[model samples]
Target: MHLPLDIDSVKGFLDPAEGRALHDAALAAAVRGPVLEIGAYCGKSAVYLGTACRTAGSVLYSVDHHRGSEENQPGWEYHDAELWDHAAGAMDTLPFLRATLRRAGLEETVIPIVGRSAAVARFWTTPLAMLFIDGGHTLEAALEDYRAWAPHVIRGGTLAIHDVFPDPADGGRPPFEVYTRALASDLFEEVLGVKSLRILKRL
Candidate 1:
């Protein structure tokens, strides 16, 4: 079905090729429960996945602290102002996203969880059909997110992670480090993607 919202404009924050692939994957999955998205930055990825969740008869749980990372834009002069505006803008995106989904006849789907993933997961017991992790890039943050969420993903469900590669110049550890460490436990096997995107399925 053709959606009332324009896909291209809604996904401006995502790289075209990668976003399309991820959207296709989400669409093709046999999702039996709700989908969880770790980061909803400007609602670009949310628009993509939310639409797919609607198609699959599932709801999307979008989680984000809305506190932009220091590593994301080092020396950000307007950090406070930008954060305030970003959070405000993020609040605005939620209704817009809901409208887009509703226009696409997906109003029944798409739930926004405005907080840290760890905190949000505490309220749910249903095994997630898909988990998209795009939260913090730091090892501790990523590892904590993974540890808290992975147990709730059903077997054969997909877990996708973004920004997994480390740039030595960026300093400190990357989420890829945490992902690699997690993979060592034999619970998940990394599925490659363009650049730093990684997917794994529960074994």
Candidate 2:
């Protein structure tokens, strides 16, 4: 897919290599159906998945609350003051994500759903071809997201989880735990692991 936007300049944490892997997975999975991702953030991952969806004539549903996550809030690491909304007295990344989609020429391919992941999942009935989990980092948050959304991935579909670190010092435990839970369920099988990203196939 042709990249109309400069992904490197994007305001998100998705690594370029990981983004490439995501794109590849979406390119294949989109043939089955639509792709959905939690935590669109500033749309770095959206650019990767959305473009692939566009090529497949499929859609990418991006779910996010726009508010900053736990680690992104004030005083915590990974916080960005520029994303702070003084008027709202909160962190907002919706504008930045919209800008990224527009510049990427993926406005039609990627649809943004502005709300909590669990809340949206309750109303989502579509069988997803691919589901990417990159939401909150707390154990409860991670568990809620997984329980609410993981079942919607079609059998043989792709499930991608980000920020997974086995080593305690590498990162938070929530994502790693989620990854392990998915595998332990006997419902998914690992097909690829790129950096901290784990790509599994829903059984």
Give lDDT per model, in order: 0.67, 0.95
Question: Which consecutive 10 residues in model 1 have the weakest lDDT in total?
Answer: 77-86
Q: Give the best candidate by lDDT.
A: 2
Give a tens-digit lDDT track for model 1, residues 1-203.
33336666552346656566567667755366778888775566776677787778778887876555554443553233332445445223345445555555555666777777778877768788788887776667888788889888787777787776667664345667766765887887766576566777767
Q: For model 2, how does the per-residue alpha-carbon lDDT over 18-136 read when each residue is reduced to its tens digit?
A: 99999999999999999999999999999999999999999999999999799999999999999999999999999999999988999999999999999999988999999999999
Off by over 4 Å in 2: none
Off by over 4 Å in 1: 1-4, 7-13, 71-74, 77-83, 86-107, 166-172
C-alpha RMSD by candidate, in order: 3.9, 0.7
lDDT of 2 at 88: 99
- The deviation in Å at residue 197 for candidate 1 is 1.2
Distance from true position, residue 24, model 2, in Å?
0.2
Clashing pairs for model 1 are none
Worst 10 residues of 2 by lDDT: 1-10
